[model samples]
Target chain A: MGESILQLQQIRKSFDNTEVLKGIDLEAAQGEFITLLGASGCGKTTTLRIIAGLELPDSGQVILEGRDITDWEPNRRDVNTVFQNYALFPHMNVADNVGYGLKIRKVPKAEIERKVEQALRLVQLEEYGKRMPDQLSGGQKQRIAIARAVINEPKVLLLDEPLGALDLKLRRQMQLELKRLQKQLGITFIYITHDQEEAINMSDRIGVMHEGVLEQLGTPNEVYYQPRTSYVADFVGNANILHKNGETLAIRSENIRMDGESVCTLDAVVVEKSFAGGQLRILFRLADGQLLTASRYGIDNDIQPGETVKIGWDAKDAVKVIDNDKDENQR
Target chain B: MTKTKTKGNSRRRSGNIGLLIPMYVFTILFVALPILYLFLLSFLQRAQVWGVDFTFTLDNYKRILEPLYLDTFWQSLKLAFTATFFVALIGYPYGYFMARMSAVWKRRMLLLIMIPFWTSALIRLYGWIIVFRSNGVLDKILMGLHLTDQPLKLLYTYPAVVVGMVYSLLPFMILAVYSSAEKLDMSLVEASRDLGASSWTAFWTVSFRLTLPGLLSGVVLSFIPSMGLFFIADILGGNKIVLVGSVIQEQITKGRNQPFAAALSAVLMVLTSVMIRLYRKITGTSQLEGML
Candidate 1:
């Protein structure tokens, strides 16, 4: 692991008395692709914008390469952002858009042209430099946005859902391409996405956010399997937060096996079944009438509604998570 | 591709054409007929006893080429151009403010801009006269404040005409520019700054370029009507300067020279077209300036 190259300390922001990013503390290492994962209005984008100097924190320090830059203007900082909407200049051609930063710095014309060509080639759109943004497809616009940010070669590249507007297949393809580009450039990438699957596929670590605060920050497996709070467990995927003996336990959907050999067996009756693409999801009800859903791969035609099933999971599979929502809601 | 389908398509086409008949009739009767009549009238002679004589002549066109009338045309252009330039300068910031304001303030600002349109233009011109007349509010205020020894002539001047014209036409500029500014993708401005562009450069490259259509529309809308506001010159100008509007008015009303008035109108139309072309070229809005 590399040293921590970017640090956000107690970053706080608000708009008109409504808090957006409430004292967010984050650390990102060099050459690492980290994602800020959360739903809309959860302050993920606000945190990323603050880190890039596009926004000034209400009270905090932003140390970039060990230099405090909290009050620096966005143009004065060595960070770039790929906005959520691509934000390509509709009037300019691709080359001009990609080379805008260098041009503003008054770089030599020949060098600008060469760098623009190199940037376009990096995004696999070498022949598209002469086309206007409106003439390009949605995926193409996203690549141009990436190329525009990459051409600056900033220390940290903030991507605010660059693949958010593309089709599913195209989003998957660009995810891999972006990972490759981040590796090739060795720049720290701070990606913001609301999709859990997307963050898992492309990030070395993901920061989960909710209500203007970071809920947890860890590797994808650690975040998924060892969530620290009930909110994080619920946000990551199907969260089964069970109350046993006045203690909270979080288990993943895939861990709960049906009618198999394991520890912690419970008898429940099948209530509902759904046929998904390759998996059959069965919802079960305990004697106390609590609902539990289990998914098994392929069609298990034998299991029907009203059938009693034995569900079991190993004792080591579940993680103890604090049920903060119940406590906070009571306050 | 099939016979029955083609017949159904033809029937639908005819139905659509029938729906547009009222609009087509209105355009032909009120718009096209007047313009054609103006064109034909410019070539006919104006007789003293019987209104327009049938004899075709180029005398009306030739008379308008004289320096006396040409100077009025030039003066009108000077006023219109200056008013449009200053309007753009002032209205652009207002438009940007309106665009960036919160929803509540945007509606309030838009309502303020539209307040003047509810009043009659002639009434508004008379209101200006109250401030601009000799020893009126402006002169009285200047003397009352000991700013001037004598009541400086405030009305019957070129500046007065421009003031009235701008006051009457400023809303067009603001609304036209506001339309473009409101639809601007604000993320583009943020992206420009993030890409190492200073605030001014970001505005020039992204925000300002994207709003060119609105700016050009403002210029055209403000300018075309300023060319025809003879009433503003009539009241505020007080016969001191014979603008193109006043000259055309004099020919049609007092001089009884319909042919010369028609000829003057044609010249103004041509000039307006030329100026619009120049505006389009300078603003880089020839392709799709009116889209949004």
Candidate 2:
């Protein structure tokens, strides 16, 4: 990350009487990969669209590279977008689609051809230059769309869940590819996605959004180990939230142990057990009717349901988080 | 059990083909037989009375090459070209904009375009007559606006016939362009804009090229029919305009020479097929039939 390159200040938007975004403020440093993470209808996509100049906020300021560009046309802004559906021009071949921005700027034919070839090579689709958009597979189309957007050498690239249409395996491959491309080009990326894993995996900082408000913006470690709010804790990863003595606390599922020396311990019953992804997860219920989950490596088939057990977690692992129930009620 | 089910399906498939017999008969008798008879009549000699003689001759075909008939063909081509030009000019933007509208407005506009089809085209042409006639709706508006002190005598003119042709055939062009325009993905246009192209550039490079098949189909639909709509010329241009259809009608009814009329019709059919072939070559698809 370098100097601040883009900023959104007090952005608010409403559509047909439904407030889609409250006042949102954010800053992105140059060459930074920031992910807006949220579920559907959480205003992440709308925020991306606003930054891309596809949508205008009801009241806000979008500053790009120290310029107030809130009213600038999309073409006039120094930003490009990779749409979710990979909106390639069906009438044009892969080379033409990649070279469209250069052609629009009246770049010489030879230069555009050379740059298009270089861009296609960057995306590892050099031999697909003559193929029409409909002839390409979904993953290939996504790469072409990225090539097309990056060809303009935009200052910032906005991606609206560009890998959402791919399967899980392909999506993981593309996530690594996109991170590599962002680094190789040194272009700032503002990505929007509903998948927290993708956000945590690829982002320099993840902005966890919920109900038109940003819950927290921090590094993946900070967001995971030390979430600022209960919503962020529950939404980011599996957590065992506990409330005691008028205070809210959260502990990672993996932090709780079946039998270990710890700062706090409780006697409980093993209520349920399941194995997934080479890990054994067991649910424990205390006499007070409070449920806690504990995860361990490998399948521990010896632990049967309804058996007596003890659960313990260190005090350092339990982080106090703001209970948003009252805040949500106020809003 | 599966074998018996497949056997029953095969029997039903054969029964389905059997049900199409009336359609085949209707097509052969009404469409195929008339065209065959007309082709045969074109090669036969005209009777001294009111029927074609059985004797074969090439005179009727050669008679179409006469200067008077050639000029009639030229006039027909000219008027049809002009009408198709205006139809595309007005209908393309009308349809493209209509597609960009909201769904409710799109449905309303489609309804507006289709309402004319429920009425007889002749009656609609008559409505135009009331507008184009001297001291009619158009002249009254012009005079009331003080644009002209006297009636413009717009009726019985070439422009009036062109107007009639366009008015009668515009919905075809609009509907054709609308169907393709509605299917065009707007995100592609947005992608173009996102790639540093302006709105106008995006429209020409992406939107226009994508919808071209529809526009060409609309042109063909309007062009082919305008050449044969003799009633439009008869009602609007009075005796001033003479098209190939008017000449064919004259040879059939007034001249009582069915062979010559068949020869004229055969030439018109050849011309239309040539146009359709050219359209197919340009679009590389049989989209003309789809438009029809």
Candidate 3:
């Protein structure tokens, strides 16, 4: 990551007297892929919209490239958004849609045509320029939307769950393409999604949001391994929260071993066993009825549902986390 | 089991066909039969006394080409065009803005637009007479405001007829535009703005283009009816202006020339069909803008 390109300070927003974003402060390094990950209505999209100038923050400053653009109109801002529904102009064909921003700027028609062709080539849809938006499939439309936004090459690109509507396979494919495109363009990308796997796969850093608060912001490995709060731990991945001596600790399910050597060990009965892809997931019930999930690679047919198993993990691997307001995080 | 399923499917298909019987019967009797009778009557001759001669002649069609009747058609076209232009100018923004209003405000506005319809249109036109008549409510208001020196002869004129036409047909224009504008995806505008298009540009390039189908349909609804709403011309114009419908009515009742009336009606029908065909060609869609 290079020097910071965008800064959001003490941002707040409300709708109908309900405060959606409490006070969000974030900084995005130049050319960095940052994602705001949260469940629905967690204000991730609201924050993204604020950054895009689609919504005004009730109180705060949005500084872009050393300029305060808090109250600027969306058209005046040097930022673009890729909406979840891929809001393409149905009246325009793919080429015109891609060239819309340039046309608005009154760029020469020949240059616009060349840039449109280049942008189409960037999205690998060179043959779709003459096709209407309705003629393309969902994936194709999404590519056209991306092409349209990127044709202007704004300083920052904001994506609000752009892949949310696609099938799983197409979504994964888009995630890779988006990451690659962001890297190639070297534009600061502020992405939003409720999908943790997507965030982990694409983002250089992930900001985990909960209940209008950004719980944690870190790299995917740091977030998965060293979550600051129990909420982040539970939301980002499957984790077992164990309270000992008034300190909260989060251990990743994959870190828990079956009859392996470690500093800490616990004996629990196998409550259920299921196969998940290449891994075997076992749900174990502790003596006090606390359920802990453990994932291991390959087959372990010997351990039946009724059998008792020994689970252990190193103390260093169990990162200390803050006990959150919600007690339901322990499960 | 498959045999029973196929049998059930066939039964359902036959039931569906049975349900269409009344629709077919009504279309033939009310729609097709009248057009056929009008076409046949247009080719017949008018007798010296009452009704038609029953003898075939091209005289009625030829009579429509006469300068006196041609001028009536031209005046009707001009009046309808003027009324339609005013209707579109007032209605497009009215309906478009109404669609963007908060739900409560939208419902209230829609109710305000619809409340006039509960009363008869003829009654509404009569109400307009009270406002447009010389030395009446409009004159009193203008005098009270000291905008004019004396009462103006505002009633029973061409402008009064045009106003009545607009007042009566404005709702259809509003409703037509509203139905289509309501379905406009607002995010497309936002997306345009995000892509550096100003608000005006976004509206012109995105919102206006997308809602054009509805505006065109509104024009159709207002224009076609304005030409035929001769009662408005009669009550408001005081028979000073004669439209195609007024001529057709005069031929049928006062002149007792039913075949000539049929010929005039047939010509109006052809004009309406041509307009509809032009509309379909321009819009490239068969569906009219539905009511809200």
Candidate 4:
């Protein structure tokens, strides 16, 4: 939709003899918040590091704002990264840490002070300017890290699981805060995280990775509703995958209705049922002995573990995914 | 049940106290008592062959203020500081390189630093003597190569003494700085660089500041032993450079003034304690608990 601010063409990286990134090609539009989402060791962080110029790709081109910056060092690149640990300077107070970039550029003292105040206020940490990083809580430290990065006003902002260190509630809150900040700043953000919920909640586009390969890249809705591979389907959310010919048909647990009015109805015995907040998660074993999970809301009727129930879903809800074997072969 | 639980707790507390008493007794008997004795000995007059006729006097300390003994103390301090300064300057980069190296390289380089420790300090000083002597390998090679008309008098000099001390104490500095540098999280350095700081700026602002504790300890390690050690100066300095340690040795063996030697030893110990306290204050480090 806009000119590409950052582009990675066929980037490859390895540690020792093990390949970590296998020819990753990705592009981020101006003002886009793209997340590289995957499980651990899936090269999501490696890709983000490559984009930030922290790690050199074996063979690739990194173009930023239409300039080939593949060989640019991290300090030379107009990009800043917020590490998961925050990595705040333990010796420096909040204002000094935030203004470090400006000071490095030899900006005027008054300008640096003004910018630091503005940045601290942006992260709602105006009063924390005199405190050291160790004195701050995890959430406050994360916000300081964000303030430090945003103070630079780089063309691209790389985040390596910036919320991974926070507690669950704090992480959720930071997720909203980060999204809001991204929208307000409109800088291209290349975020890396293993948390699928975080990726789905904050990203304009989610690139799902599996074992150093990009499985699929799309909007969150597309990744959830129209997964291109079995790994993506299982990685993005809970899915009941059934093999049909060479392709795997994946149906979301919530899409499989229990009314038994659909064409593909199977007699299943309820194996387990869990009351999870507003929804009930019912695990079932079909006549073919295949396990399936289904979620139903506001269902007062209780189903015993051994009780037989007819489970069905419309054919339209079953998205076809390439079989694991086929996907591996393609790679 | 409550009585039994209380009894068990009291037994455990007594056991812990029992374990702690021996450590306290050992420390007091071997460490604290000797230091206290030395402090008192410094203020006493010399005894006449263990006759137990003692008088409190500051004569030994006053004698040290004379030019001959005073120069030795000043020289020892200057030499110790010089060695410590060079050790830090060289060791910081070496330690940084070691920290950034791969495991294999790090182990190999650490072994290079440690190999000297396995050998005796005297033997290492002997090795330096042989290398720096008038007709030793270094001089012979230089003369043979026609680099100079005569064999240079390098063996018995202040530079030779400084060089030997630096060689001996450099490993401690490197190891101390290396331990700190190895534990440093690389993300912080990257964060600094990402903020547009140059490599040198990042190193000074973040890397060096974080490793200050190690550097301070290393300085202390190098300074303390170098001050008290007269062997390197005795061997390489040709007995011309009289350090505080040489003065103490002279008072005991050559001068035959045991009480004065004891007084000098006490003064040196006090100086070391003061230096250590100052170092801890500056670096905000507690009394170093781990082996250097």
Each candidate's interface RMSD (Å, one decimal) is: 0.7, 0.6, 0.6, 0.8
Q: Name the candidate, 1 or 4, with the larger DockQ value.
A: 1
Q: Second chain of candidate 3: TM-score? A: 0.94
Per-residue alpha-carbon lDDT of candidate 1 for residues B61-152, written as tens digits (9 for 90 to 100): 89988999888888888888888888888888898779899999999999998888899889888888889877989999999999987867
Q: Where does candidate 2 chain B have its weakest 10-residue lDDT segment?
A: B283-292
Recovered native contacts, candidate 2: 0.87
TM-score of each: 0.94, 0.94, 0.95, 0.93
Give lDDT tens digits, candidate 1, residues A1-331: 7999999999999988999987888899999999999999999988888887787889989999999999999999999999999999888899999999999999999999999999999999999999999999999999999999989999999999888889999999999999999999999999999999999999999999998988899999988888988778878866777777777788776778775676637888999999888988888887767777777788855888998878867777778887866665421
Stretches of candidate 3 off by over 4 Å are A260-267, A306-310, A326-331, B1-14
Sorted into a CAPRI-style docking class, model 3 comes out as high
Best by TM-score: 3
User: TM-score, chain A, per candidate?
Assistant: 0.95, 0.95, 0.94, 0.95
Q: What RMSD value applies to candidate 4?
A: 2.9
> For all candidates, what are the clash counts?
0, 0, 0, 0
Q: What is each candidate's DockQ, to 2 decimals?
A: 0.86, 0.83, 0.91, 0.82
Query: Per-residue lDDT for B175-270 in model 3, tens only?
Result: 989998999999999999999988999999999999999999999999998889999999999979999999999998899999988998888889
Model 1 CA deviation exceeding 4 Å by range: A260-264, A328-331, B1-16, B280-292
For candidate 4, the docking band is high
lDDT of 3 by residue, A1-331 (tens): 6999999998999999999998898999999999999999999999999998989999999999999999999999999999999999998999999999999999999999999999999999999999999999999999999999999999999998999999999999999999999989999999999999999999999999987888888999989878998888889977888776778888888888776565446778999999979998889888767788888888865799998867778777788888786453452
Between candidates 1 and 3, which one is better according to DockQ? 3
Ranking by lDDT: 3, 2, 1, 4
> What DockQ class does candidate 1 belong to?
high
Question: Which consecutive 10 residues in model 3 chain A have the weakest lDDT in total?
Answer: A322-331
Candidate 2 at A170: error in angstroms?
2.0
DockQ of 3: 0.91
